[model samples]
Target: MAKKSKQYEYDLSEVKRLIGETDKNYREIAAETGCPYASVVYHGRKIRGRVNRMRQEELNIEEQQPVLSITEETTETPKMLSGGTALSISRSDVHIHDAEQEAAKMIKAARALGLNKVNITIDR
Candidate 1:
């Protein structure tokens, strides 16, 4: 008579989640979950690799799609950027996630206020 091989069900997702989200090490996770140390290490390495790939993909996407751009205002108008009054981006909530978006808004405001533009420099 032929017998089926034994199957063991283990939740590797839990280990992967801990590795990707928490600061816990593989040894700590293995100890906490009673999973084999080797299994934990293997899963941890795989999770980290996947995360790195995901981050790289995100960066590539960002690079492919420009964060900011100006399409020519397709109509007869005053010479574009035709002003002498130079204004600067001077103030805002410096701590922000999307600095480019904030700066774009500031520049748009400057243009509305009849400014060609001057400089955008940050210093410590």
Candidate 2:
């Protein structure tokens, strides 16, 4: 007589492993793992929620730092560009230019840290 093969049920371990491996949605995980859609949805929420919580905690810690830590003052006054620039800038214009430069530096730092487009989604 021939013996029949047994089917295995989806478990938490499999779901957690898939969650850690891919950033796919619950539906996608269900299709990929051959598990039930409801099961993936249920467990995937827990996994994603944990990750989002950790991210929030880290952000909270970073927010405690002082905003205006730089206290250095420039001794020299603003001067015109050495290349004979056509645009003449006033004192207020120099302040605005300094603000723009600071913003640019912040953007460069964010991109360097791989946070150019951080999307913290915990749902489908």
Candidate 3:
């Protein structure tokens, strides 16, 4: 004949409730609640650690998102300046000296054609 092993019955809800109600260690919780010491230690630590990790992840996601503010002035399109023209070029596509050379050529041509008040804008 084979010998049968006996199982001890425990309530997980009661264990969790006790763990939440006190700052005591697993051993203290087990003694107070009449639950197994190992069960209290494992489940309590695991649940608490998981909650903490999830909170940290949420905080990280919040930090990564940019905060935007709404103001009345920013809703309207800006009006262009009168008699102003823009010459825009990318810095990576052309060097500053090369841009200066091109601007000089344009200016020389404009002056030869009797044109004045030319506006040139170079930005990175």
Best by lDDT: 1
Q: Over the stretch 25-104, how does candidate 2's per-residue lDDT look in tens digits?
A: 67777777777886776776777764444575776775565332212222444232446432222222223225556545
lDDT score for residue 104 of model 2: 56
- TM-scores, all candidates, are 0.32, 0.31, 0.34
| Residue runs of model 3 more than 4 Å from their true location after superposition | 1-6, 50-124
Residue-level lDDT tens digits of model 3 in 1-124: 9999656577888889877776676777788777888788788876665444456578677656653321112123333344564332222334333556666776776566555545554443
> Which candidate tops TM-score?
3
List residue ranges in candidate 1 displaced over 4 A.
1-10, 50-124
lDDT of 3 at 66: 50
Tally clashes: model 3: 0
The pairs that clash in candidate 2 are none
Error (Å) of candidate 3 at residue 13 is 0.5
Q: What lDDT does each candidate get?
A: 0.62, 0.53, 0.59
How does candidate 2 fare on TM-score?
0.31
Q: What digit string (tens of lDDT, one per residue) describes model 1 on residues 6-112?
A: 55455677777887898777778887777777788788777776444457677677666534332222233333454543344454334333666667887798678
Q: How far in Å is the alpha carbon of 107 misplaced in model 2?
A: 38
Q: Tell me each candidate's RMSD, in Å, in order.
A: 12.4, 15.0, 19.7
lDDT of 2: 0.53
